[model samples]
Target: MVKDREQNSNKEKKLLVSLIWNFSTELKLILMALLVIFTLATLLPFIPSSFSLSASDFRFCISRLSSVNTTTTTPTKLSPENNTTTELVLDRVLDNGVIKRTFTGYGSAAYNFVSMSAYRGGVNTFAVIGLSSKPLHVYSHPSYRCEWVPLDPTHDPVSTTGSKILTDWGYGRIYTTVVVNCTFPSTTTPVGGNLILHATTGDPSLNLTDSIPVLTEPPNSVDLTLYTSSTKKKQYDYLYCGSSLYGNLSPQRVREWIAYHARFFGERSHFVLHDAGGIHGDVFEVLRPWIELGRVTVHDIRGQERFDGYYHNQFMVVNDCLHRYRFAAKWMFFFDVDEFMYVPEKETISSVMESLEEYSQFTIEQMPMSSKICYSGDGPARTYRNWGFEKMAYRDVKKVPRRDRKYAVQPSNVFATGVHMSQNLQGKTYHKAEGKIRYFHYHGSISQRREPCRHLFNDSRVVFENNPYVLDTTIRDVGLAVKTFEMRTIGNRLLRTRQ
Candidate 1:
């Protein structure tokens, strides 16, 4: 009986050992499987699903994972429908020289600032133009002296060509310069006023008006006597031409350009030059005789920083000339130094004006001359004789071929001017002199050449044997004199430098 019990106990111990060993093996297998699953979950995001996965996409996915936390315990406030709510916040307002306004219900909207200026004639009249979110009815009221004056119904608001609504909210946002003529308390005294612009969105009751300040004097008013060289004090007859010159130009070239105009226009024409920057001292020396003779005047524009770019400053310079010579000059031609006004039918500009006397009967004050562009050719001579007429004698030259249009104008009829066009305050008409006159634009050859040569016209496809005008011998003579003067000046400068 004792032997039987011992064997039974040994059998039970072997069975228990086999069961424990099997359980341990199964646990190890399960733990290994779980470890594999965990590893795969961690590395699944690292391995791209497609071979075509881009670097940007991978970076975006990494950024998103880093921004989110799956183990967060804090509960988020969820909407009733479990949807996310977004709120738009208004940050800050910026006025980068443009008019901007933000409305409560209509979101934020911006428009160009309303500008108001009194007419040069007197304080009784002023003009305003700007962009508006709604169709605005502009009205004027004097601040320190007079009461609210309604805009003249006869002078209604007009849409300008380049004006447009910047925002997507409304239509007809462009408001042109509407002249508001009001009876002032005193015309001589400079008065400050405010313009009230009423905005309407179809409904008359919902109209809103905003006040804009108006000064009797313009903020950018240039001195009237700034750049005049005439000593006689006589009115400039018919045409007074001027140009804004930038960059270092040869003295001989400068004299040739000035002399060409002087020869063609005669004593009736006077030129004002605004030397913006980079004008060599030699240019001034070459022009000293003309400067003393009151034919050419040069003003240093290095100090003026009113405008941003070179072109804008040029426009301002031209406008200043207009205001300065308004009473002194009958007509003003704002052109570049390389450009020359040519009237094939007449010898002088005064004669051209006399020919257009019939057109002036209809109150046509300004004339628009088209430009004929001339290209350069390989040549030895830098200066082209007779204003490059022989070299550029082709009929297919680029020209402004339109009637009742002109780039030149009567100064008294113009309020302001741009680079090429004038804004007339007197509501004058433009007569285009397409066939009768042409602006010789010698930009290509004038800046490149140093001597007069016939080889410059070799590349011209077409050539004409007939001469356009009687060859002005005075131009050639003046050119020679200028060349001689430039040479002497240069030699003297070199000698002084050596000493």
Candidate 2:
């Protein structure tokens, strides 16, 4: 295993080198040099006898150098962002079932391949979660890495594309998280083939060293005419894809969340948790029981911190999670551990999900709750002693106009997704999911707190300056039942300590 890893590492290093040594960039430099010499010769006759280089003259040459394309290709293909990120653990599963593929850049653009799905009698499409916002040319053809051989000779490749910006505050000259919906002709079986995105001017087939491999679903997946009685595709009800867990996290809250969601989603639901750095001794201990039960999956993504992509590289992590478990689940939920997902009292979990199954994706509204504030009107603070969701039950009275809503998607339909919602999905998306379902956003509940009750209000109407207060103990009511469930399943010893 060690020897194989070494060989693969060596191969990756070679691929990185080949991407850096771009032919078109070198040619541009040579052409630039010729222009400089020609321009200098043309202006020589105008100078006086004792003509020498001046500061301004030198500045002109330096300006010329700036435009000249250098061999220092920071953008690359199928490579890590920088030297520090070389230690990132990538699952290079070249099987047809594999979901995500990432690339640095092939000179002009970078690509973070989330996954690809193919359909017969239509188009073959791939989702790139993060890439340069600038438009790109894709080698969607399965066999050719850079060659754009269309099934029909007249079909325009440039017209078929989709994109959505996932960045809030901008980073200078870096890769931005965006959705890409580029397609190719679908008929030939992909069989885990390779494809690349490039700005190749010459024959694209020549620059095949850094093509990223993709996982394509069978055409029969979406094609009705190709139905087979013997087809035994695995199916799941609900799957989770969470953001990177970092910083000091509240283990008490994490434990309750795991237990609650596990029960909330029932036996078949599987949660995929990414441990960027936060899942420490206590958090890991809390996750141990769920991990043992095979209900929770922990991916150690600590190395992804090297790339300062949006919010601890969370967009990349979630996109990876999506593609990684694309076909495995009927519906995939994306959110953070800090938030407790709650199905309202009126709605049953199965009925709510089933009702919304007709839509490709639905956004869950947030009931932003306070982490520090508590409702003393119910009783003294000592009376409530279950989980963070139980004790800290104060919610924001004033609703913010902005949409910080989380969402759930039928993975098979979505091409690319954001932290808040999904894009390029086949079916319509329901943006307003207020009464049907929503999540309680406990703002800073993930951080460890000694008391948590900073200001105990008498009634629900009492408002603070920025932190308006209102008592909504709905989840608090459910937290008690979850406590009982935890006591039975994970053991009372675990719950007793938290109490």
Full-model lDDT for every candidate: 0.46, 0.66
Worst 10 residues of 2 by lDDT: 113-122
TM-score of every model versus the real structure: 0.46, 0.63
> Candidate 1 on 78-142: residue-level lDDT in tens?
35575865443333334554333433334233332333233333334332322232333233221
Q: Mark the regions of model 1 whose C-alpha exceeds 4 Å error after superposition.
A: 1-65, 68-234, 239-243, 304-306, 310-312, 345-347, 357-406, 449-499
Q: Write the per-residue lDDT of candidate 2 for residues 130-232, one digit (tens) a residue.
A: 4332222233221222222333335433323233334322431244454444465453323233334432223244443333333333323454322222244
Query: Candidate 2, TM-score vs. the true structure?
Result: 0.63
**Top lDDT model:** 2
Judged by lDDT against the true structure, how good is candidate 2?
A: 0.66
How many collisions between residues are there in candidate 2? 2
